[model samples]
Target: MPRLFQVIGRQEPVATVSMTVYLHATSADYAAVGDDYLLVDSRGARGGRGFYDQHATIWSRDGRLLVTTQQVVWYRVTK
Candidate 1:
């Protein structure tokens, strides 16, 4: 799991957790592309100290599913 959490620097995650996307719905089909409005919704949670997780979904104006993503992150503050 460290392979998934490590990205940029040498920072390490002492604790971590995973989350799943709850809902993703679409109304219309956007197979033919031209121009359309994109909508997004997201929600997340934090352990209040070391880690947080979030997921988001993007949809076209006609309610076509465009993209969805979820991520877990570990962070620290230093000066």
Candidate 2:
């Protein structure tokens, strides 16, 4: 599986992040991609206090994006 990273926030004029994601072949005869976290417990990845923004979204590999919801608190995708 290719490595992936996800930043939780809205698209800003200035990118304030350090992460990247990779893509792999799917057996379904199609291409696909998504975000990843080093640990299931993402709060460990944050050095300081954690934060969450309802208006925030995510960017995946190939510069694709996944829409977000203000009422939604967390999002997860798996293959």
Best by TM-score: 1
TM-score of 1: 0.49
lDDT of candidate 2 at residue 47, scale 0 to 100: 26
Model 2 / residue 3 / CA error / Å: 26
1-79: candidate 2 lDDT, tens digit per residue:
1112345333222222333333333433122432342112122222222222223344444444433223212223232
Name the runs in model 2 displaced over 4 angstroms.
Answer: 1-31, 34-53, 72-79
Whose lDDT is greatest here?
A: 1
Steric overlap count per candidate = 0, 0
Model 2 error, position 22 (Å): 23
Number of backbone clashes in candidate 1: 0
> What lDDT score goes with residue 67 in model 1?
71
